[model samples]
Target: MDGIHINENLMRRIVRSIDKAIADDIPQYLREHYKETNNAIIQLRGDYINENLRNLVVGGDIEFVPFKRYVWQGRIIVDRAEKITYTITTQKTLRAVPRKQRDKPHFLQTLLYIENGGYEAPVKQMTLMDLFPFEAEALENDYNSIVEGLIDPAEGYRHYVIAYDAEGSELRDVQLEFLDKDFNIIETASLNEYIKPDFARLTDVEPVDEDFNDETDGEAKGLVTIKSGLRPKLRDVQKQA
Candidate 1:
């Protein structure tokens, strides 16, 4: 990907349009890529910002922060009220979780921080809800079979849901919301310490667990749980040179 230096001109045009102060969770890299514009791939970052901005504004809403580029499926969540607007940058803000994997807790924590360390009760009580077909076949002996469905349903079949919580969090405390066919709403179970610069440095994003049946419940443990698939890790990014 070394050949992939971002086009600078696009970044300028795009940056001039977004609300960066409120969208701090958005990576600054977008400002670089948005220096130019592409007509063909409007859904590309350029298009996303423009489209999201256009749609939100048409509905009498406005962007409180600048637009950002997301390497994942889910990115920003906008909430507005009379005379005031704010943006929530969630964990999915990084990119996306691997197939069947999710980035809920991290997203929630990020949202909480962006909202000043406290969120509405509805946002706080949310949890991860899976959309993939649930089956028992893909499960590692049904460790959480009762509350969660199997990874696959048929014998040697798998249809299921798998959720991971922060060290001090729990499954029962979480609330679920049906956002749509493709997306599920996850509310934070509660509030915790706000993330500071030191805590940000402590961000230890881990690698995706390639082995689904590693007898370890598909967790690599200790990762931020939300990461970019298209981008390299800091170490990996530096080593490319």
Candidate 2:
């Protein structure tokens, strides 16, 4: 066995322990308690999973915040005056999750609201492509629609492109422009960025050999050569003087 295997085994044990702890503690709470609710249970499970996994993987002064749903509001401006309000709901803006594991700007759903007598009323509720017929034409013409055909069913959400910070740790406030087939900006919207903490530190783990065999004797065993099988070779070692 190697260090990776050992670490994975340790993680599995820890996860099992945490699961056992949750199971044991759940009975102490009544069914009417909020902890017994489906959302609460899911949140608790996610919290435990992230906390333990981060402790095992990142180590030392690191924290993990699980992903949560958020609604981002922006406005699409047409002709520099005609503006429409849009709202997107997604589970991408993780508070303290790692950049690699964080969700992309996936849209769970989108609502386009048109101003009616100074009050916004939802006019359409769908993807950008479905909401605008011109987007479909643009797609057929090989024009990138900013957000088209990026839906992930497995993700159970919608997707839109959003700017990230330099560190890629958090979303950045920026305007996403909707372009026509001619690559001209037809509309622009200001996207609200979700701020995330910068305390996460990723670390590398060095591998070490793990003994798998239990049988042993007092005398040191000589090298036992094997044929017709693979053997481990030492690489990248400095030659001794």
Candidate 3:
């Protein structure tokens, strides 16, 4: 568990393995484009160590910046008219607590894309886990099979909407309204406005417990108990295993 004891060579090997897996799993269209570029499939690779660890007496604590071992970049021609460049970043970390009492490292990936000349706005981004079934499964299972699970592309799209609606984002003014079965408005809010302190205060004071008649509270209590009581023991058992 000591970060100082981390094997840089092992980490590098793991990164290379994942990179190869990603390259091998790439779609034929993307691979053809990559071949056209004549550039290495993996364009960049680096390690990140926690700088704060230097100031502490316990110097073993370290964190990989970007939270991943390496990053890859390349371009793909979607059609004869347009070419899209993409960056893929990966993370491999030893989790303090692992799922199902399995003490395996966690793997995560992010994908970003932009047109060659379209830099006016930020790059379109999504998690690899949020892609369509074939792509998502390919990326998730590419390496050592440590991925947690797949997330629906719809969820990723919702996340993009929320992020884009934040202050300073292009869609800040976009409002989303939730409706009930009868078409009655259940809630209406803008993402940026919803995060304001005033908005939080207003929403926090709602009589949620009264509205749900203790059912919500009971569910919350159950969740809290599971988190506090079962989670740590599972982690400990995982470590032992």
Candidate 4:
């Protein structure tokens, strides 16, 4: 099949929209949706997945300069400054294909990551079991979590999530740190929770999705009550319920 053309500009727009939409819920959404494919727990979040790939390649990072172009094995490749040549392909590539089935946004991010001088992150082999109930063997077998890290000797890839409250004034980026036997903020997600209860810890007492009440049909659900701030009007004197 002839490869599909992915316009760099259009792809950028779509990625921007995706990152904005997902800046809140995408991490969880990706984990739940793409867990089965490619041995990935959080398939959408790849070390090679560049939400900002276009910029990294073109805009300011002139450090990565393309030196030459060559055609080999039915694909035109771009050779960069460091004596490395990259094949120029589109959605036809294996990494691009599986990701397309998972999520378009994540697919694009992965491609961008690959094109910008990084090894492709093994997102295709991840699963939910690896995320919620990950074991040492499962992690070792899969190529995603640690093996794909930018820096080797990068052991202990723990996703320590910390939550914060946004009190309608300003956004305080409380940098999250993770711990060894001690503590530290390893992986961080920039979340904007501008409402009540900004976040609940995965360890926090799990709230029921639906409030549980043992009472009768009409005796009010979970702590139903009249609003205290409901101000009565002068017209209330004219009539009564």
Model 3 C-alpha lDDT per residue in residues 1-241, reported as the tens digit of each score: 1001212322222222222222222322243455435333223111111111112111112111122223321211011111111111221111111111222212322222101111112223332222332243443343222212222222221111001121111112223222221112234333333222221212221211212221110000000000111223334655665
How do these models rank on TM-score, best leading?
A: 2, 1, 4, 3
Query: Which stretch of 10 consecutive residues in model 1 shows the poorest summed lDDT?
Result: 167-176
127 in model 1: Cα distance from truth in Å?
12
Q: Which residue pairs collide, candidate 3?
A: none
Task: Give the poorly placed runs of model 3, Cα more than 4 Å off.
Answer: 1-137, 142-161, 166-193, 197-241
Cα lDDT of model 1 by residue, 1-241, tens digit: 1011111221222222232211222233344445454232222332344444443232222222332224433222222222212222223322242233433333322222222222122232223323432233323232222213311112221111112222111111111121211233322222112111222322432321322122211112122221112223333644654
Q: List the candidates ranked by lDDT, beginning with the highest.
A: 1, 4, 2, 3
Candidate 2 on 9-93: residue-level lDDT in tens?
3223233323322332232232335432343342333343234344432222211212223421221111111121111111233
TM-score of each: 0.21, 0.21, 0.18, 0.20
lDDT by candidate, in order shown: 0.25, 0.24, 0.21, 0.24
Compare candidates 3 and 4 on lDDT and give the better one: 4
- Give, for candidate 3, the lowest lDDT window spanning 10 residues: 217-226
The better candidate by TM-score, 3 or 4, is 4
Number of the candidate with higher lDDT, 1 or 2: 1
